[model samples]
Target: MSKKIETDNTCNTSRRNLMKGTGLAVAAMSMIPAATATQAFAQTSEWDKVFPKSDKVDHQKVPFNNRYGITLIADLYLPKNRSGQPLAALAVGGPFGAVKEQSSGLYAQTMAERGFAALAFDPSFTGESGGKPRNVASPDINTEDFSAAVDYLGLQPYIDRQRIGVIGICGWGGMALNAVAVDKRVKAVVATTMYDMTRVMSKGYNDSVTPEQRGEALEQLSHQRWADAEKNMPAYQPPYNELKGGEPQFLVDYHDYYMTPRGYHPRAVNSGNAWTQTTPLSFMNMPILTYIAEISPRPLLLIHGENAHSRYFSETAFAAAAEPKELMIIPNASHTDLYDRMDKIPFDRIADFFGQHLA
Candidate 1:
């Protein structure tokens, strides 16, 4: 068994301690109202991804139910001329508010071309997926979303369930780690340009949010629930990825990918819409990577841009996870650069990692 790291280098919050009560959070997550499995979703056949459609892979829209019974919509990608034998599969998601049509889809398609069955799904409540009071985010449900994807992939006749792996990009990277830690069926896992959404929400960027600030934020969220009760609706934030003059470079980079044509898709929450006002509440209390060390014995690979503002999230998580773990820092890449910049995204290295482990 992999023992939890006693200390974290980037932040003082001990995940070892936080994991003590994770069972309660998991139990609470199981209680979040589930929807019917037969829920119908409308999808257009037109090619609408931010990235160009790849001809080397066979792509199709698929829907699968999570344990919460939310129907997640995904695009499945398989190699065009692969053998009849069952092949290794992967479940890909993330960057949080963004949908599968953005970075995750691109990753899935590229990996499919490299001879893996890849499913890129929009996490529950986002994109074409089925969840009420839409655009809500959850540390637990989102983590479960990845495992749900694994379930779907494993059921397919063409997939070798024992050779399954996961690839989480940006914020989904954290979700991927959390899911793999619990879902041992996964043989290997990789996170690229990762962000720990819970860490960022709870502690703020770089753990800069003081304890008083955290308390104040939680208090505001608690009170906001009453207003939501009165309105019978959850309020949403203002349109995300909007840049006023003089924003930070990383924000500008995000705007470039999400708001601009470079990576925008109409259905993506981060593109032009907003998340529920209280979306941060669940994440603030639940540290998703609390049991990251438990993923050991399953190879874990974390990729991050050397200059990304969120690099510390990966570094912190890397410190917490046990061996057979590796942290790969890409030279001269920014956070968003890995989103769609094929030249900057290390697909070959990722393929090699999965190939070796899933073999």
Candidate 2:
């Protein structure tokens, strides 16, 4: 059976930072319920401190269908008081295990304030989206999520169908690149703090998992599936960052955001629940970017923090892609910095990239 997780009332600071440049506050002022500003401020302290409020965009809830018939939820952001013609549209999603309400929504809303139509959507089986056996992932279905967003945007009256772009953050960054590889409708693509999910699941980070280790993982997953069938309950694993003493910096950074009020969203799997215990099997067997070179002619922007533990994923992907591609490294920033740190993320550069290509 399918179920939708109810969103928590906690106001995320990371989300607020992503919306700072958008004039959503002023436009939605009257629409906002009688919640006290003090309450809002207190609940949003971590996020607000990092990202000041923006009062230049309009935000609204939007629901659309994917090819699988799952009802995906998104927060649509549109620039306020724009001039001439309708502009290009952008569809953003990512960090895998996370909902649109977190970093992806922030990215969409921020870009919208920069004068593009942006929609950040929750992938199937997660967040407010409708799906059965929650927290499962598939390479094909996930890639289709991007295409479905494109389909929805193309039908919008205020959008230029021919000029559509996409931004994928973290794990979704890899998925977005995979989408652009085959979908010609994507005119430009930006992958921020990217992770190649296939590589990590198959070989483990930094190729720490040897062929024998990989085989053991496969055997474990296969047996876990049989156990799941017998028990009739989806196995759940806790977030990797919930480590104790002597954890790695990458895990520590993840904890600071996903596990705390600063970035937590109730619907985020990474913030709480683990995905299906058997998800590794598919991710291991599927290499998402085997045809990455085909994405040429359309521009690709790959951004990563120089110190990010996952920087190699973007470097390798950039090398795999053909011309009309660029790789930008943010000095001294970590993986999560690109998730919501506006000062660290090159928004102006991203805006310019999309504008040039989508034009």
Best by TM-score: 1
Candidate 2 colliding pairs = 13-47, 20-54, 22-56, 23-55, 23-56, 23-57
lDDT of 2 by residue, 1-359 (tens): 11111124332234213323332111111122221111000111122222344578877778899998988877778889767587799999998888777888788889988899999888887777767777777888888899999999999989999999999999999999999999998899999999888877776665555576566667766777777799786565444346576655676888898888878765677775566666666788899989888988888889988677787788789888888788888877888989888799889999998988888
Off by over 4 Å in 2: 1-53
Model 1 C-alpha lDDT per residue in residues 1-359, reported as the tens digit of each score: 32222122343244223333222221122123332222223677777898888889999999999999999999999999899999999999998878888999999999999999999998998889989878888989999999999999999999999999999998899999999999999999999989888887777666666677677777767877887799897766666677878655777888889988898887877776777777888888789899999998888888887667787788889889988988887777778998989998989999999999999
lDDT of each: 0.82, 0.76
Instruction: List TM-score per model, in order.
Output: 0.89, 0.85
Each model's total of backbone clashes: 0, 6
What does candidate 2 score on TM? 0.85
Candidate 1 least-lDDT 10 residues? 21-30
User: Which RMSD does model 1 reach against the true structure?
Assistant: 7.4
Regions of candidate 1 where Cα sits further than 4 Å from its true position? 1-41
